[model samples]
Target: MPSPTHDALRTPAWTPPAGNTKPPLSSRMMRAAWRGLPARRYDVGWEPGLVVPAPDGSPLITDHYFPRAAGDFPTLLVRSPYGRGVPWSPMYGLLFAEQGFHVILQSCRGTGGSGGRFGLWRNEAADGRATVSWLREQPWFDGTLGTIGASYLGYVQWALAMDPPPELKAMVVQVGLHDPHAFFHANGALNLENALVSGVGMAYQHQGLAPMVKATLRLQRRLREITTARPLRGAQASVVGDVPWLDDAMTHADADDPHWLGTSMGQAAERLDVPTGLITGWHDALLDQTLEQYGRLRRAGCDTALLVGPWTHTSAFQRGWPEVFAESLAWLRAHLCDDPSGLRPTRVRVHTGGDESWRDLDDWPSSPAVTSWFPAPDGQLLQQAPTDAEPLASFRYDPADPTPSVGGPLLSRGAGPRDNGALEAREDVLTFTGPPLTEPVDVLGPVSARLSVSTDTGYADVFARLCDVDAQGRSTNVCDGLVRLRTTGQAPTRVTVPMSSTAHRFAAGHRIRWQISGGAHPRYARNPGTGASPVDATEFLPVRITVHADSELTLPRGAAGTVKDRGQPRS
Candidate 1:
């Protein structure tokens, strides 16, 4: 009988209009921003080193830049743990200031020149309210306040959004995390790489270390060695120096633990009523979290807009997309300054890969056509469910020889989507490849998989990745997930894992591939398979992992051809 893998390329390719990318800022905008603006109505004024008292009476440092020609202008507040004197201060301070708004760049407690112990988001809620109260006391206050920033800075906005101040008007949060557990421990496994890198980085910043020293410590090789060390609980102290939070985080694996609960937005997500704008990248580590925030705000009846692009966290920061930037500026103007020029027609805007185009949607999974794809014994993916009832493919997983971390949604090093050729070649990795697609398959929403697996070990972790295999045979990861199994009886266990969401088009002639492995070490700490704590486990237990033939991958498919904004699915 002819194999299912041979029946490839049966559908036609779907092509869409390419997105518009603006060139660098014009000389007019740059020159005017540097020197006093002549054509604009307001000139920028910079005021540095102002102190605001937190609720606990700790002094928080702030710098203000307001339009010289301002008359009761609204203000934009950015609370960041990173120093305020950096370029971010002047960039937004001058831009928004010249745009006729007051910009206050304040360092969170324990960062920059601020005089308080920084404990991540612990002090943010109380400190944020206290700062807003201080803003209201100012003679220049106009009762309209907005928040803006990305990453950690973005996180502060969400902290306040849970219980916003009376004077708050709008917010623009980019790539922020709503849940600490999702950010730190994804799917019951410690995101060892990010946790270690970020912990050491914050420690270095807190100690005011030299930039070169910080860079050397952030080196990938050094990070890999540290992450691969035995017992992750206290191994990072040598590099990071007594981070209680990191230690506590490693020990508390459960998301419901009170330690993790203190950092979560929880019911605050539903209480938020501010007009909000969200920005994220397809490869951003917090992409899923960002998307969840948008959905929650929308459901809570808040005016919200979402922008997603084909970039990584670092890329989005260093070389931001002009379209997204322009949209953000417009969002701020509309919500804070009451200017409606930047209003977007569609609430959700996603940049689809493959064709390199932008797609507007009403909501996520815009009319999804979910398709269930099954695996064959010979490493082929079929559209229909398999009939076999036995284990067709099996691999031996050794904690000592755990699969190395590769490109995906990681932080510091090896972050974002990358080719999986080398990773897929490992004996421990089992792949189910589909034949070249005849037509483009637009996958634009949540992706998940259900695996019928049996393992000899007491505990194991399953890592799954969805990839697009081009005609050249390069397998680039689209989305992936991890699920840790602590205990499973001898019988085959059925486990479901949800992968990251994305809007990508697998073009005609490209193949859809799925890779399964016991672990993506360092990205997630490897399970020792001994039912012992991974932190101190010293044994190298090799377990036989059997993936039953009936395992299935569920993909949320969008309209097949020429997708447009709010249009009917193509027949």
Candidate 2:
């Protein structure tokens, strides 16, 4: 493979045609829908299909959007594999251009007519550098550059940070991913549903809306059959049409596996000096990755800001776009344009669940108090630890009848908080509930479950979830985690399951609940008790999992008092 810039060709920037400079009707409608988006300061002009040479001399197709006004503006680069049309053209290209930015929206390798095969994360760094080099030679390039996008687009930004150009000044990573390994195999378990959803999107989304929709429908129609395949490895290829990248991701479960080396851009966060604005939702699939990068950036003393909403991966771009757009625009203006007036005073802003309100804090986890609730044999969550050693609460997990996944932090549309009443009614699920809270309790940090567990079959998975039980007894999942276990037969092992992080409140009259299950099927691949790879397992076995009375759920409690209201977020 030739280096991305090994024989880079200088390409002339396409001049925008002198035509109507008014915002398109679609752009106007989108702007209207996002109530708090920055006012459009200039009409936009677009120059499409500008060719930039990738490092290996492949043509990376790009589109340029600039203000129709007569003034220089900082450029914002948004490279995506998910096509350069529809939402991308309007949301990032037009919107940012109208806000006085010269937006360069490009298609990644092997997508949207760009030359070369898409090698997932492999081609981003060099392609990004080559694009920047091309930008430097453009007449409209003002030398100041910023990158912005969500999901895979965010991954490209991190890849660019690996060898950041001097012109790169700021970045906005929304629900982005930095580690492919963690995204696919979190806690040694395959994130099956997300993997499939992502695979479908990557394979077909850039092709066009119709193909993407058709592929999505096909996957949905065959989802059950695909997920339940005895040997899971080849099932995905049948649905997505031979996606080698997805296959490779599913095969490598170990982070240290040679296949995943250099795939993580976490080091970029730790060393990046550019001003970065991070955005995510409590229910977003990449929530943990966003928080992880925030911590790393903060520790490195990098200028960073974080915004977390009450949204899932897709909803963040829809319902949460107003706040998301405002935050991004403010951060960009502050850093790139040297205009900090719109920036918030605090570094962190998060929306608290239950209350459905936003709060600004000096730092994440603004509270230091931790509360532990022990699970008793009587299915109660008690503040005090148990003294008596009682028989363990037990449930059987059958791979043939895996516990179905409910709404949570998933990439699919079926993600976010959902009523778990039906799921908890299953025999394989265990729930421990605490008394109704007289005063609302705010939990604003990491949530975890510590378990003393044993399994008859030696191999199993422990899925722990935290929920808020409302007055009507509807249980809504807040955060959850799963750990694949390999233990000695019947010997209890103590393990701590990090159930992600959340900013939620247990409202008055609401009860706190801790749910324990063997596994959340399809969300995570079912564990076969024969010590076989889930992808290649030919045999399914039932395992009896037991939880001891000593197990506890730990929650970070915010300070007692009303969290200062940050006012209603626009839209």
lDDT of 1 by residue, 482-512 (tens): 9987547667888998888888889999999
Q: Could you say which candidate leads in lDDT? A: 2
Q: What TM-score would each prediction reach against the true structure?
A: 0.89, 0.95
Candidate 2 TM-score to native? 0.95
Could you tally the backbone clashes for each prediction? Answer: 5, 3
lDDT of each prediction vs. the true structure? 0.76, 0.89
**Cα lDDT of model 2 by residue, 1-571, tens digit:** 1123422432334344578455445666766666656677887887888899999999999988898876567899999999987678889999999898999999999999999999999999999999998987776676778999999999999999988888889999999999999999978899999999999999999998899999999988998999999799989888799888899999899999999999999999888899999999999899999999999999999999999998898888887888898899999999889999989888898888888777788898778789999987679998998885454699999999999999998887678899999999999999999999999999999999989998888999999999999999999999999999888966688889999999988899999999999899789999887889999998988999999887889999875433556544322
Candidate 1 lDDT score at position 406: 84
The list of candidate 1 runs beyond 4 A from truth reads 1-42, 206-209, 212-219, 560-571
- Measured on C-alpha atoms, candidate 1 has an lDDT of 0.76
- Which pairs, if any, clash in model 1? 9-438, 10-438, 11-438, 11-439, 12-439
lDDT for 228 in candidate 1 is: 65
